[model samples]
Target: MKDVARVIVTYDCPRNCPNCCNEHIGDVPAVKFEDLLKYKELVITGGEPMEIAPRVVEMIHRLQANGYNGKLWLYTSCLKTTKWADRAVLQAVNGITYTLHHKPSQKDLSDVCKLNKYLLENLDNRAHDRSDRLLIDSRCYTEEVLRIIGLYDTGTKHWSSIKPLEWKDDECPIPDNEELIYYDLERV
Candidate 1:
């Protein structure tokens, strides 16, 4: 059985990386926090959860206060960890997953590594091994649907009248409802 439930807390990310698959980043509903405790782990994600740092920390505290003992994993771009407030909020989580693709320079990579090392050294190690405390992924997910969410074919549309509007031939079709529920964010 899958014990982890990856929560899309918000779709408010500010980065414009080409491989983004989260189309709902600017206008998606936040997941109900209480609904997450039934799983063994809750992975909180957003356009950038740290974008609203305080709220995310409050939600984490709320989860703990409500007797949810499962791990709380956070997904981030590692852009705001340099800020003391954001760093504190991140350290509170049980584990962290960073999108390595977002690192634009050696400085960003160095910061990410330093932050991950600190997190691995400081957070409780009950549910995660030291090596598992931080995860870095080049592409957030390997699944085709998840790697290409906002893209669409504009066939027969206004400008496409000249030619069939097409997404990159390599692009994968978005999944239907049945396929979506089975997506494994932990693997991303």
Candidate 2:
């Protein structure tokens, strides 16, 4: 497993990606800065972290203040970074990963791309004294599971059929006689 802790701070996102495990995440406690100490990298995710920009900034500041010098990675939709305050928060983080999902309109993509361009330019200028860790979707992984099984091609559809897992009948909830099969789509 990767030596990274994915701390999800909120279950409230504007776009409900079909593959998201947000329902299972529930209302977990907000992350304290100390929670990041055990890992080399800390990924602050959410329904969308930008949903609570001020709180995110506080988390970053707290981690920095406590002398936790690990790399901080932010996973966001790039929707809220359009605001100056949110951009400032992004400027503080070491790296960012933008989530690419179903965009209903070209305008949405345009706005996100605009912010992406700005972050690429501003967050990587050594002459301007910013960190050199600005990133797009550069995940170091052997495999990726595109869980678009429940995804819609467009619009506000959600994963209504797949509810959060529930324990029942004194056993885990796999079908009694079903054999689970996994397929390897590609090899890295």
Candidate 3:
């Protein structure tokens, strides 16, 4: 088994964003929970995992119960939903990388602030730098993104970044990098 695995919460998604990475995680057989135990890290991502928030919460519990000691991180846009701030979801993961969606509206920025506040209040462990993160989608890192990010900038932590968003391309990796970084993981 590889040292890392990106677990997709579901094959289906409501956003159905163009060139979404979920569409290109070519069949490698279903990655069972047990199969993931050997990994040093697990990144729970999705077609919006919050869509099945309960199942994700349970999955986190199950992984912990089975003695999976990896760092459990999650990736989500959290734009259309604030459920990511729910207590169970907040407490379970080691960290969360909230992607600030492209062309965000004022409501989107406000919602993110609310969610970050809830994360700080509910989990003391995450109150510091790096426990939670904010990333501006590279495609949308315009003046608007800067303005919105600055709205909530506490400046205590350098948490906001603008990385290339993940997308599917015939020869590109999930991070939308033109280079094929590593060979696809194949089970032993």
Candidate 4:
């Protein structure tokens, strides 16, 4: 397997979600600044990255300061805290993989939809200095999520992997795919 420089910045999260693959807990020490220097591509993931947005932004800046010109990708659930809509936070990230959980609310959906729209709108805009950034759809297994994937895939490519969660005997459906991509902080 090709080695990718990936780090899980924190275990703490704001949401107690069910579909989460990485069941993170409380905060931990910040990622080592030096580890980021050696990696060509850095993936920053957590229970909720937005909760630690400032730290994430600072880490990115540190990497850039050290002359690391690689790509930066942030993984987030786009919860109330992970506000990708904020221009400042969006500016720091080169790309984002927004994961959507099953929460049906107009405001929540609208917020996510707005961020997606913004990413497309600003891709090539010279004014924002984000002409070279890439925005990818990284939604996982869900009917609604799949629909969004189909929509984005019509024109652009998105990343999707099968991740089967351990189910209890009383769980409604049985898993069909044996090879499920379980989340691991070390293997970003």
Predicted structure 1: clash tally? 3
Question: Per-residue lDDT for 1-188 in model 3, tens only?
Answer: 45567676665556556666655656635655567777787777766766667777777787789988878777777533355434577567777788776666687677666665555455434354336666766777666555555534543233434354543254325442111112112221
Predicted candidate 2, C-alpha RMSD: 14.2
lDDT of 1: 0.50
As for lDDT, the candidate ahead, 1 or 3, is 3
What is each predicted model's overall lDDT from 0 to 1?
0.50, 0.50, 0.60, 0.50
Top model number, TM-score:
3
lDDT, candidate 3, equals 0.60
Ranking by TM-score: 3, 4, 2, 1
Q: Which portions of model 1 show Cα errors greater than 4 Å?
A: 24-31, 116-188
lDDT score of residue 132 within candidate 2: 25
TM-score of each: 0.57, 0.58, 0.71, 0.58
How big is the positional error of residue 42 in model 3, measured in Å on the Cα after superposition? Answer: 1.0
In model 2, which runs have C-alpha deviations exceeding 4 angstroms?
24-32, 125-188
Of models 1 and 2, which has the larger TM-score? 2
